[model samples]
Target: MRLKRNPTARYPETGEKRTVSDEKKRGGAFALAQRLGRSLMLPIATLPAAGLAMWHTARLSRRRTTGALMISVALTAFLTGITEPLEYAFAYEAFPLYAVHAILTGTSLALVNALGIKDGFAFSAGGIDYLINLGKSAELSGGYLAGPVLLAGIGLAYGVVYYLLFRFLIVLLGFKTPGRDEDESDLDTFEFAAAAAVAADRSKQKVVHSHRRA
Candidate 1:
């Protein structure tokens, strides 16, 4: 006689339905994405202020190294929205810290927007546009005093809040950010080597082609 298989029977190793733990992990990932998306608003919202802050910080720094660093940070943030590199480095490992970043970003945006401060640019928001706008007219550009004050406050709040919240979350969650995961480290190293090899090969080919033309 043929035996009938049970429809509800699950393999010992693989369960048919997702467990609570699995569901939580999925939820965490979604939450991280949501927070990261929200965090973007902060950078985009503070483009003009961020550019001004960079310029002011660079001017205030007595040391060349400090000024260079400040300028680089400002330019990168303004031009390309490259905040993701640093943000993702922290976000992938310490999701809670990223969440804090998102909250702070939203708060800063709200505060600035509430003050009726608005900046427009044809290209990416950054130092170039900020300076351009400033050159145009101080009064026309939402006045001088309120814009600077709001920017300063937002900058200070971002720095302090991010530091405190990141530290607290890291300690509390024991997050495994970059350099904390063995497997991830190995993978990164391999990928880097592979990319380098490909770049080197391309360079060599270019040199050979140039010699052939010559």
Candidate 2:
């Protein structure tokens, strides 16, 4: 589900109206101070999508640093259950990380199912969806806190494991995950531009030579 972005996502994160080079000002500082996890990391284990989103986006979006796309995407997956953007961050290069993600996601789903934790989503299986479905799940299971608490516990543990494991693999193995890898397309563009300039220069030189001969 595409998160309808606030005209200005604020600090309590950033208030570039929408995003920015100016992120570190205040909003950026807050999320950074906590490192986003210092709890946001909890969601990916349950949602098994993001927290890593913020981590990866932070790295890749250094150009934007605290830009809107980075901030919005990370939050969207946690709140709305949209993860394609986040997944794309490392999906192409880090197939191994993706495989790990699949295992963790499957485990989350299977465990929830086995425990009979009923939940549903209107847009996706995000926090809002979880909340909306909370009542239904609780009634069926005869407890309120049980579902949230258990889910939180599992999600946090999984989140930590993923964070540490992913960090290790990315750092140690040097997976060309997004920000870490230069886009071949960018290199191609540069090469093409250079060739075009060279051709143009040669064409001009030929015309000048012909004029001198005349």
Give TM per candidate.
Answer: 0.47, 0.56
Candidate 1 Cα deviation (angstroms), residue 67: 17
lDDT of 2 by residue, 93-153 (tens): 6788778778876666666555544333333345765565555444444466555556656
Q: How close is candidate 1 to the true structure, as a TM-score?
A: 0.47
Instruction: For candidate 1, write residues 1-214 as lDDT tens digits.
Output: 9977433333221321221113233333222222222223344334323323322332222224333433444445555343443453455556666676667776766665565443432223334444544422233224565544455456556655554555456546666543334344445634533543454355446634543442
Candidate 1's C-alpha lDDT? 0.42
Off by over 4 Å in 2: 1-70, 182-214
Q: What is candidate 2's CA lDDT for residue 29?
A: 29
Leading candidate by TM-score = 2
| Candidate 1: residue 178 Cα off by (Å) | 2.2
Which residues of candidate 1, in runs, are more than 4 Å off? 1-75, 182-214
Q: TM-score of predicted model 2?
A: 0.56
